[model samples]
Target: MPISSDHRQYWQTNLRYLAILLTVWFLVSFGCGILFVDALNHYRIGGAKLGFWFAQQGSIYVFVLLIFIYVYLMNRLDTKHGVNE
Candidate 1:
């Protein structure tokens, strides 16, 4: 079956947003948590070492946050495309 133009546009927009969000996800997780962990550990937030927390827990938290953000954006896109269900 042929897909409608609206479906194609929705998918394209979704893919673009996914790519950008994933890139930022990777940078925050690996770049900040692992690569710069030592430097980050010098800083403290709420009495815990920032980098340590980021390496151990913060990245995962950020990932979950990103998921919610992606979903929210996707929902908005769906409305724009008249594809919400």
Candidate 2:
């Protein structure tokens, strides 16, 4: 049997969110932590340079934050789509 339109829409919305979040995660993890490390190093984060902090700590923090945000957003999406549990 074919999937319903609502199910398809839910999956599409989820994929869109995943793409956006992954892009942001990548930019924060790789861009700020490495590619733009020199520029970010100009700033300080407590005892360490900003870039080093981002590479070692900030990326992890951002990833965790993104995970929570994804959960919250998905919950809201589920309610909006009448699929909440």
Best of the candidates, lDDT: 2
Q: After superposition, how far is residue 32 of candidate 1 from its true place, in Å?
A: 1.3
Cα TM-score per model:
0.84, 0.95
Candidate 1 weakest ten by summed lDDT: 50-59
Per-residue lDDT, model 1, residue 38, is: 90
Estimate, for each residue in 1-85, the C-alpha lDDT of model 1 and write its tens digit. Answer: 9999888988999999999999988988998888998999899977889887887788898999999999999999989988789
Candidate 2: count of backbone clashes, pairs at least 3 residues apart or interchain: 0
Candidate 1: stretches off by over 4 Å: 1-4
- Per-residue lDDT tens digits of candidate 2, residues 13-34? 9999999999999999999999
- Clashes (backbone N, CA, C under 3 Å), per candidate, total 0, 0
lDDT of each: 0.90, 0.96
Ten consecutive residues with minimal summed lDDT in candidate 2? Answer: 40-49
